[model samples]
Target: MNRVITVRELIEVGGFDETAVLAGETFLEKELLGVTSFDSPDGHKWLRPGEFVLTTGFPFLTHKESSESGLIKLIDDLVEVGTPGLAIKLGRYIESLPPKVITHALNRQMPILSFPMEKAWSDVIVPVVRYINDKQRMELVQTHAIYERFHRHLTSGDPVSNLIPLLHDVLQSPISIHVPTLKWNWETPPAMRKDETIVYVDKQIGQHAPRWMLNQPLARMTNGLFVRWLLHDQKVQGAILLRQPDRDLYAWEKVAIEQSAALLSLEMERQRTVSETYQRFRNDFLQLLVSGKYGSRHMLIRKAEEVGWELAEHYIAVVISVKPHSSPDVETWKENLTLLETIRRILSMCDLPILFGLDQHNRILLLMPATENDESAAKGILTDLMTTLALQWQHPVYLGIGRLHHSWEGIVQSYHEAQISFRSATHAIGLANAPLLHMKDFNELGLERILFADKPGAEAHALAEEYLGKIAQYDKEKNGQLLYTLQIFLQVNGNYVEAANLLFVHKNTIKYRLQLIRDLTGLHPENGQDQLMLRIAMTVHSFGYQA
Candidate 1:
């Protein structure tokens, strides 16, 4: 199963009359792929990793002053570039190797090989090239056989599950394929799991998934072949795993895995399209049911059954939203899909009887049977999900969970609560306290929900103006920043240090402004009541004002 050709094999192919390893004899086992001649100092560029170089020692030997130094530098360059070994055709341009050069090569463990005096550069390069080509030809035949074996199954339009057997055949090992996102049962999509196959993640990459147990079969597992389903922008859709636990992988085996991955990508891409369509239908269906548009209870049950939901008589509704911002439309879509898939996998792995779907509003809707600690369970799910997502998205994505509903039909009310909670969180952006809410914990908004329930009326605006009209007028007249400073100070709970940060000013500047506010408004912020009054006035002014 060894695919790597070694230096000794190539020397045997060259049929050198006499050969000796001057240094690094142990390192002669280095794997070599091809060979080329190096007559100049910069000829290293033509050589690649795992290649042997044939040289006349021209550039090094021609320099009599520092021939040893030149050879030393050449050896360093060869080792740095990953050239396996060097074969010098002796008694040509170079008379003999310097003792220091031999020691240097030994220290570096770089194989310094010598060719018979009769062998020219052509003799070495030709045989090595032919040897590499012969190996490649044999590899091609083996790789072809593997490809054809899988190509037949691919051509037959077999389900992705068929890949397991084909890979088992190619590698002569047991194989398993795990698609983390593939879940649920739907007749139209044959690939969809009938048992709702769960993909578990306590934060592990695809390669790290646990191996299934097979008794007394495997000694060691090989690295998997990951056929990544990537979008045009290089966003991965998912991966198909191929593993053989019985033996170490050869280069040809890896190549075959790559081929199977390609086939799997095409197959999965087609399934993705079909799945997306079905998901859209599911989304529309859930939106209708949750929006309370069902004509009868039977109709609701029927539609729910169509999407494979085993709904309980009583249900609790939850909504998860991704706060939107400026991102490319395509990028946003992909992220949402990826997030939904992950959530689905996690829920399925937990074996929770949850019916979930994505709506057009960038929200995930869920219906679960009401339980004793359903709220606590929901909180735990969001806690782990948000932590995982913060790492997954590499950006701060927020979510809001509505209060549990008494009945499934109460989704409309619960969803609205989630929206309000989400609003309360997002509205606090740029403030000292960020909006990171989950699972009915939107208590952070306390009374602002009522105070700023609607856009400020004329009366509220007039009241705000009366409280700080002098400061506003002064700002307008002199283009001063008293009002701006006041707003930041109030938002930071009258903390001068925090207010200074918002204004990008020193604490002295904030103090001077606070004194000015006291002199101008006659409302001393030093008083806790006055601070509260000022905060209320500011909230009234900014009511329904969005950035």
Candidate 2:
């Protein structure tokens, strides 16, 4: 409704014709931009579209050779140029109207009215102009009112779902917002975006920031269209899907959708900012807790409580590291925000107090309440999370789980165990012909659970490092195969031929390397006690751990 005054309203306000005598009456609802008056014969030549012309019949009276026909041509010309209507002050220069002009104006739906000879342009022009300007002002007020309502809803922390009903009220059309990226909180789009819409949207998303039609029904929905991209600076956050079931949208409807998208963009940006801030806070807190920096359980509990975390006495830790598939459009190294929400949504049903964070290496660290009896429940939750993430996103994700621990400091212990288990699983999965010790194989991870687990007197067991440390230093200095030869030799239980087969070398070469290993250290290969010590050192070295 925020537009120029219509021709019908203009006539009523001006009282331009007492009997309402109109040559063309079909298009009274046509909008008029302004009013102009002229007495020249060629006045239509200088007229602008939407200008309602007022004239005394001088043009027709002066040109006597082509009076009726020329007037009819002028009437047709005005209609073609979108002049809504014309007002002729008759009875002075011309006696009565020409029938041809009236017939031509009527055909084109151009309203042509005749006023009295005594009336000046001022009598009608001022009143009509005042009415148009007043309507224009009123339209501005309505537009501001609409904008303010949307602004209040956006700033009031209402969810994006709440805006759908608001748009319904504004547009008077059934509308839905389809954002595939953030579907966790929103309803699924009326029609699932098929391969057609998906491919098109994917190709253009974050590229075009505008309202557009998909040119057809997206999927199940029929007869409604237009997708407005929700963008902040070139990045597409989501989209708004407008539905007008019976017909295409009007100009004002399009305007309302665009304005609503603006408010939606703000909501998306604010949420992004808040999510980032919260994730960062959680990240710092998790790091501090796992770093063992706090002096006591009381210190940790107080800090955890500050963030509304109810830290249970017994807790289990989980760590995940994900690497997204390579895409030319994305940065492969950055931690994906999608991973955060995916984890949140997947585990939301577990009925446990969950606290989680993301680490610098694109790792996720989560602590969940656990007890002796919750083993099956914990595994079920983990299995659900792992399966959902893998199936939904199809990324290379590694999950490391730790055994339940009873104390606050045990939380740090659980974290280290989980990280070590993760790295160990990764290393094992990479070995040629080795059975994979995957995170999902919790039942078979008995040895892995103790591989890097905390135990008393780690320094005492570190004595094995003295043996391998010399061999490691020699290999570093000479790039020799002595360290590897010693490890293989012990692994094969001092068998020259078996070690040679495993190393893909001649038995003589293996013997030769064993002699060199003997020269480097006094522990000869054939001695049982010395071989046992060397095997211990090899095992510790292979773990990539000194203690």
lDDT of 1 by residue, 1-547 (tens): 3546777777687775444677787776678777777688899977788878888787886544438888999999999999888878677777678899999999988887777777777777787787777878887889788877877887788877766667766766434454445541212123323221113212332222233311211123223322222221233333434333433456677776667667766766777788778778789887886677778888887887786666675555555655543233666667666667767666655677766777656566666555543666655665665565454444445454555666666676556555555555555553233334333343343344334333435434544675578888877888889888988887787899889988899999999988988887667676775676677668777775321
State the local distance difference test value for candidate 2: 0.65
Candidate 2's displacement at residue 146, Å, is: 3.6
Give Cα distance to truth, residue 3, candidate 2, Å: 15
> lDDT of model 2 at residue 18?
56
Residue 474 local lDDT, model 1? 79
Give the local distance difference test score of model 1. Answer: 0.64
Worst 10 residues of 2 by lDDT: 429-438
Assess every candidate by TM-score. Answer: 0.61, 0.48
lDDT of 2 by residue, 1-547 (tens): 3347777888788875656656767578787888998878777788888899888767666444337876787787787777888887766666677777677778888887777677778888898888877766766676677778777886798876777778878776556575544452232334444435444554444333444333322223333455666655544545666655544444445556777776666666776688678778778788887777877778877878766677776667777665421223334335445566656644543444778877545577788667653656766766666665554444556567766666667777677667756655554452232222146332334334445444523522443564567777888889888888877787777898998999899999988877877786667777876676576566666666542
Best by lDDT: 2
Give the clash count for each candidate. 0, 0
Give the distance in Å from residue 354's predicted Cα in candidate 2 to where it truly belongs: 2.4
TM-score of candidate 2 relative to the true fold: 0.48
